[model samples]
Target: MTQNLYIPASTGGTLMSNMPLITSIEELTAEVITDLLQAAGSLTESQHVTAVEPVSFGDQSGLLSYLYRVGLTYSDGAQGPATVVVKLPTDDPNQRGISDALGFYNRECTYYNVVAPTAPFKTATIFGQAQATDSTDFIIVMEDLGHMERIDQVIGATLPEIETVLKALAKLHAVYWGHQDLENLSSTFLPMDNPIYHAALPGIFGAGWASLKVNAPDLLDPEIIEFGDNYSTHLPQMLAALNTPTTLLHGDYRADNLLLDEEGNLAVIDFQITSMGNCAFDIAYFLSSSVTSETRAAHADQLLHLYHDTLTAEGVNYSFEDLEAGFRVALAFCLIYGVASFAGWDSFGERQQELMRSMASRTIYSILETNALDSLNAN
Candidate 1:
């Protein structure tokens, strides 16, 4: 069962204010672990953590956050997992600013606190959570799901894996298709039509293109570069077209964020960009970013239909034609991600650079193959 004890520094008053905004692994001491667990009702007065060993995900972690595998020893041999995953804000000021501006930290914390328990798909269990008053800083002590097999995005995913993930994604869309919870938390899970996106994405995209010109010039040819230059001008229409048929979106649904087991169970993580949008956008983002061009060319039609079939089987009214059309527009917009990859060029190493290259190449290929921008104009 997932714990519901979320004490934000803004609202938890005296007690939570006392809970340190842990910005580093060194601050995640044995005493701090006891407080977090106790606050979440996972520990008692007599039961406390006596020692902690934290191993950081120095390079494998996301740009917006730092991750650690914290091994724990409890007093009197009280029961608990040998280790748990601790997520904290990134030390990079620029990255932290980006996270705050985009509301990434607050969104993920809120997703676990409010939405995860009833969510249809699998995700890490939140043992404890604390957000700063400004929502810029937060800590998530969650289940250590590192044992699950993670797919490599640079190598890309197989047809079977994509099929399984899409089917599960369809179910997630079906369950939250027009749920009131979406409306109740509209501010936290911004609808695609939100003006804030219009305000922020253009500048970020422009910066990304500039960064790429300097760092990864070979990645973008003139034609693709021309399309990127005109992306912001077309943003409003694309976003307007994507706003309908709203459902819960796992905004960054890709290979790296997924964990699969032998039984074929799929667990999704990284809800930083979680929002409300057309379900097809999630499908587009997943396929364009995670699968190779060959896989998409051979199986795109079948895989898309599989998602449509799965969604309709759950009684959704979306048409296959509409899904196809929305997919094209979504694919065009996925360039934002590929382009954004360059914005953090200094932060990424050779492996991450390879992954970004794969993503950018596949995204550009799919866009041209489908004439995604023309589809967007038609929309």
Candidate 2:
């Protein structure tokens, strides 16, 4: 579809113009990029600042962003493009979870030594520090993974591709488990009594599953409330079960968050939700989140083996026992996460709401109808 270019004459020289929030691409300059970098704390008081033009991509913030790609030709003539993402601010005032989540992203980089795309920021030019703008506005300068494919595109791939992601998921889970104190990992993971878990809401962790059952009764069985309560009831056991060998699990390891660079190696984005929970939560969430039921059913055994075999290969000492257990416990993880996020899509601009919710509604319907919880439990 051709973007409708706004012409001043078309509106008969109105006093106001409905230009895109960010300025036109041709107007990007070194001064603009320098200002954005400084906003994110990338430049010092003395350093020369210059920004090339910016190109933007799909981002969640309502603010339009321009990716300013520039070359810093230094005094010694060494030059390279400094890729910066410029976002002025978002319009969402009541939004929550920006700080701790960005902290988690930075905190994960501290342990995992991996670059995080979703929450990239810098306190200094050389080191990474998660910083937020005071007025719910900011820009982020990040590493550009040149020509890498997004995980979203590869998700519908053949068996081997799925295996690659599963193995990586297991490895991530195993490597970062128990590296930090639970309080530091996620207050949400600790019981509500834990004061650090203070501001956290138990809403999404399990309640939304019950609410969805209440809201969508025609499509889902009311018995889902039983499953939801079972999850809440077994919270202590679930916490105890977290004692199983842990690693840094990518909380949202869906295809959309994984990037394939020019070399086709996987680079992950979105560190905002990184947590110290059981590895299976991420594995099961990633495996189940985006696909259709027919696809999931057809590929079930093959993909399970991919996850297990990857764990086994990495010497995680996983078995069918571990996989099934993870699979079962992770079911609630998947269902509830879906329910918690449903409203976001429902209100996205009409087309966005349509596409995102259509897929999501199908996912929810399929999950309930397929008895993902029951099947995982049965296994």
Candidate 3:
């Protein structure tokens, strides 16, 4: 049986209406707009949103959510915002099935409503967030950070950018490092020790691997394929080894999910996969998947040291050797996502395909360089 989790939007002192959830952009009616504005604190009792002009938003290819941007005008002839991005779950049955199965939507909603207030790192400000009982019907209305310059994952990050990301991530990890109360949090934040994840990940990896082999054969080496094939079984022990002194992980921490303001401060989005895990998981995932192979080869050591130094400065007590070993394991663990992303190659255009290929190349290279497969199997 699947459990349902629901999180109501932040009402910010206003009474919430019993409006039907907005599941798609087409359903963004005037009443829905008013409800959202009130919940987001953008409208007071004296002010009301009279109209909305829907604007263009994301690439429309998000597997989990559909994004929309809309400008709102108030009754008092004032504009609420130039635009705000509205995120609603993808209506596709297959995609919704995966999200529900993994508790992705519930986790994200929890992040905004429960976690963001105290999180150390910068994330998109949530004006409102809500989910249906089943977690399938959900929406997040947030400040549009689209104006900030975004790094191209295919082009990869520069040395400065890599340093910035590592430092930011270190701060986030340190905040919850070995917090005694973490286990009492929602099951949505559970580490891989949870049986639900142990049961689900293997099948997901196998399906993804099968698709990659069929769709992008040239990218897979036999060693990498075999590593992926056997990974699901080995995952339990490997995750157990890596799970100690756990912290919050920004599960999809990558260039594509990050944006930089004019002063170059980094802000992150997409907490759908946020979980409790070794900090090295995010570190390895970012370094292996978001940067070019050459960039990582050149700066991997320095980057790891930077992350370690930051962690130490924040009063965490892990040694460099510990970090290095966890990093290697994490690099191998990342192959699961690297292969899984290719399952949607047919939906990708030339540039998207190029990005996935580059990520794969970098991930495979890191796995081989660190002898990640051998390490996992040996453990």
Candidate 4:
């Protein structure tokens, strides 16, 4: 956990008014990696460590710890690159945060194959132990696609490119269709499964909202706060309605986690929250999160038609009208989550916190104040 007892916003001074400690972003700490490999039973004294660091990606990835890939030379000179991205849980008590985050790493390695050449998604491999004795437990060693950029950056992705990504989701969901009996079956990706919806509600509903209504009244209204409270109350029923014939959901199925190969093929990554839920969950995820709100709002119906068209092309026999109905039902769920994303991640600051608290208010308000639920009710 950040040692700092963070105020809702910066108090205009050092994060810690008194206490101070050092933080590093150098190559993987040899000691940390050594402890990791030792715990995994893969460490030999012969293996030498090179580097470790918390890296920054794009403009939005501010809080991530990206241990940059390295060269691993075995005793006999057999060598490979260390490409594991270990996302550890912070003891941060906000929500059962890192607790839920661990699921993503588990799903990625235990369920989703990182190296399988079967799909067009940016695949990643899992390592032995998720983390050391610390709260951080999920670790991933992946086939580094560092050479490629995310599809979002590669504008004008040909029909083939988009087709590849959408088809990959189809192929995955098809394989895992209705897999509830298995011991390691996937769980619902986001929705109320998120820590905020689960554990952070007290904080959000209590201090967070109370603070907002008093200090930042312009950011939210009474109805918004009510929506947040009601959403939590409605979570179980909402999730029950969402768990139709399940498909593998790439929890965060946005371009951010997708790496586009040299040939512009899509490879999905960041499966920490992979779950079994409505196939519409994945569709809602892709369209709602991947496309900008403006573009998606303008093209919502068009895109809904396209998803059914894409699914049909892949040999799945579902009618557009019906599928769109399912998707629309899921849209209220998506819109709630989507609006909340305005709080965004990638950095730790007052602005981010305010954005999150405000957006949560907006999410609450919008869900309650308008006829937004009409989409879910239309059919």
- Top-scoring candidate (lDDT): 1
**Tens digits of per-residue lDDT for model 3, 1-379:** 1112234444532212244666667777666767766776777656777767777554545256777788777786544666778888877555566788888887787777556766666788776655676446777778888789888898898889999989999988987786665665548776856677788788777766887788778877879877777878788877786677688788989998888989988888888888888888999999998988888998889899999999999899999998998899888888877776566667756776777677777899999987877677675
Local distance difference test values of all predictions, in order: 0.83, 0.47, 0.77, 0.47
- Candidate 1: C-alpha RMSD to true structure equals 3.2
Model 1 per-residue lDDT tens digits across residues 206-321? 87778877877776777678888899988998898889889888899999898898888999899999999899789999999999999998898999999999999988899999
Candidate 1, superposed: residue stretches over 4 Å from native: 1-20, 38-45, 60-62
Error of 3 at 345 (Å): 2.7
Displacement of residue 65 (Cα, Å) in model 3 is 1.4
Worst 10 residues of 2 by lDDT: 1-10
Comparing 1 with 2 on lDDT, the higher-scoring candidate is 1
Which window of ten consecutive residues has the lowest lDDT sum in model 3?
A: 1-10
Q: Would you give me the overall lDDT of model 2? A: 0.47
Better of 1 and 3 by lDDT: 1
Model 2, runs deviating above 4 Å: 1-49, 52-78, 86-94, 97-140, 153-158, 177-201, 205-219, 225-243, 350-379
Tens digit per residue, CA lDDT, model 2, 10-69: 222211212222324454455554444445455544454543644446445321122334
Candidate 4: 10-residue stretch with minimal lDDT: 1-10
1-379, model 4: which lDDT tens digit per residue? 1111112212332221111111323324555555445444565656644554444342332222333354443335423345444443333343234345444433444444322333334465433323322323434443457777765521223344445666677666554454433223423243334344555533333444344445555655554445444655644555656666555566666555677767766667665556656777776656544543444555556656666666666566666766665565555565444333332332345644543443344333334433445553443
The C-alpha TM-scores of every prediction are: 0.92, 0.64, 0.90, 0.63
